[model samples]
Target: MIADGLNSKVFLAPMAGITDKPMRKLVHSFGAGNIVSEMVAINALSRRNAKTYRIADVRDEPYPVTVQLVGSEPKLFAESAKLVAELGAYSIDINMGCPVKKIVANKSGAYLMTEPKLAADIIKAVKQSIKLPVSVKFRKGWDHKSVNAVEFAKICQDSGADYLTIHGRTKSDMYSGNADWDIIAAVKQAVRIPVVGNGDIDSVYKAKEMIEYTKVDGVMIGRAALGRPWLIAQTHNYLENGLEPEETSITLIKQTMLEHISQLQKYYGEKMALALSRKYVCWYCKNLRNARKFREIYVKINNTEQAIAEIERFFAENGSDIDERS
Candidate 1:
């Protein structure tokens, strides 16, 4: 059962450089309630880069889509929100959780969490600029020493955020250890607007616990969905029927990879698709028999045709069963 509310509970996180339109469509087709596009730099949107315009486009999806913008400047942030709304975004999501060095150095992303006041200002500017619903996604805080999700949630709400998504780990933790659901619960308690719990929800059991324990309005899964976008649909089914997800077969996994590659080729040209698919290619091959050998072969190929051929040959000749537990 999809969580009923102003916003559906299951959202796809805005993974920069990865979750393009093709991948976003695939995740949605698999049953994600809400999805965010890849993070776009606010500064880039303001300048109206042709490449950014292509990335910001969201005309294909039928469901409500939120475009995430990252930046610390108030005026530019406001302008960017207006532009995105004009581009037909259902909502605007401000990213304060990205831990990339480039974003932090620019006083954006997770670094904004260090100053709740400034974070609030950016939200305020965006809300004031656009009529669409505005939200914020952020880490626990800048680091463990400064962990304060509750305070940040309040700041965002007071400034005009319609909802909040809290990634359980602190900025300092990066992608290590476990994401603390305790703090996410605290944020829920501190704010009246819906709270979306994120981080470390890699399984159906964890998804149920995060919602039931943290009392969050929704949940967002990140890295866990790398080669397994179907996890979102599996989670939705688990919530609805209590049925375990069927284990993904080696054949189906290979087919999915091929389809994903084909979609990338359609959206981006052959060269760009080949380049972007490398990381995904590596991810899909993980833990399989002869994966090392496949990686050795796949990484060396430069053309899409060769890469596809290598993938088909490896799976047909040496693929092993994947343990698709949920």
Candidate 2:
């Protein structure tokens, strides 16, 4: 069952630099059960860093806005969690699953998995500092040789974390190889609180399969939602009504791309929007007939109008009817 006040069981995972405000808004609009802000560093936030604060902004988005914070110091976690609660976050997620070398070097992210007592202390501090529901997202363990997710989950539960998200990979694996669902199932059985299974759930079938195989309370989609925000809605529909999703139409795809551009432009001004649109353009047009060529051209564009014009031209040349308004 979903947590109280949450609408669905599918969640959009917190991807740093990718799940920004515009992306979160788009995915939430597409009916993702919950959306998490990109992981913000507690040290930067406690220092009132402008860029960090900007990235953590969740004004006017959907309910249950979960702000994810990553850091090693328990005091900083407490301070940042209080700030996030004051900023109207519905929940606060401690990010212990990030596998980046830089993050781990700072004694944060998956590095905490190696120091379970420290991880538990941070969770307790954050939970004590805020009224918002506290959750922790972590990996299986430090490495393949030491898989400690079950022990870690128990530590988090005992420390007052209200929920847990487990990515079924060790820190050493990074994003390579297959995520061990058995590990996630083990975590679920070990913890009484809701456990969210994450990693490699790139399709609706995978989402359903993970839910059934692991008996997880939910599934968190990360890389899969890059271009296809509708996947969240489609997965929700499939799970709730047993409806299979059809291939998205070209017309709808173009419209979705246009809408994404519009939201980006509104959030970040035109110039920054144009720059940011390049990656998303590549994601949206990845399967098109001339995707490589389209990406080459998209990367060279310097303005929003030029980006929009190229998108229209590209789709029109590919035989899709243009909906300029979208």
Candidate 3:
């Protein structure tokens, strides 16, 4: 069973290529309840692919770390779940919500919404294969005409999934519109297991509204967290104590960005870190004044020292008007 002792109700969604160790560490430091690893392909994992193994690594993250697995085969899911358990994962999350074209074409991710039997079998197999809590993340349905999240949630619960996370958009929607919290609320009403609501939850008020509107057990934040790791902390504090969050200073934001890059450098080394830092630096500076100019310089940076120098200079010059989005 999933532990009920989580410190907060704010969770960091498992975003591909974005929720790596450095990002997870930064979010966890700011008090996220649980952090999930990027989706690991079961087929690649079974072959012992080095890169896939690294993607599933959670050795240094905080407790209650979850490893999310994506694939269509039950046996492979069972095997991968066992491997994740062996690697010390506290929970296993099945990825049935991804909307990527390649993943859906492979009968994984949101495609499973159209194949409930296989989805249930995969959940059953993983649950029976390990002692860790098993959860599934999925969308409303395959498309507008086939909204089956309520039935899907029931199937997963009956098949032994410990919890469910429902992203309110359908596979066809692909994140183009607002999430339907009412549908999520329906799923919660239909299932006995805990349900987490995810999609477009970018602010503390929205987080609060989701919990109240959907009556979900928790809220998951994905894209909104790209530039603001402290969002989870802000939402958690707001939910716990209804108090307005204190304004974060520009200095603190710059320091956090520096720390984020420094951690990436330490973990991935200077060269690889510079490559990775480019995208993150863009997100961090997305709200700064002269952001376009800053990104132009930052994205072309060839070394860690140069990247760090540019970050410091940019923040020093534009520190007066921090983005209010945080």
Tell me, by TM-score, which candidate is best. Answer: 3
Ranking by TM-score: 3, 2, 1
Quality of model 3 by C-alpha lDDT: 0.87
User: Can you write out model 1's per-residue Cα lDDT over 48-127, one digit (the tens) per residue?
Assistant: 88889878777666777789999999999998888887777888889999888988999999999887788888998998
Which candidate model has the greater TM-score, 1 or 2? 2
Q: List the residue pairs that clash in candidate 3.
A: none
Alpha carbon deviation, residue 320, candidate 1 (Å)? 6.0
Weakest lDDT window of 10 consecutive positions for candidate 2: 317-326
lDDT (C-alpha) at residue 37 in model 3: 82
lDDT of each: 0.83, 0.86, 0.87
Please, what is the TM-score per model? 0.93, 0.95, 0.96
What are the runs in model 3 whose C-alpha is more than 4 Å off? 1-7, 321-323
**Which ranges in model 2 have alpha carbons more than 4 Å from their true place?**
320-326
Greater-lDDT candidate between 1 and 3: 3
Query: How far off is residue 165 in model 1, in Å?
Result: 0.4
Q: For this target, which candidate reaches the highest lDDT against the unseen true structure?
A: 3
> RMSD to native for every prediction?
2.2, 2.9, 1.5
Go through the candidates in order and give the clash count of each.
0, 0, 0
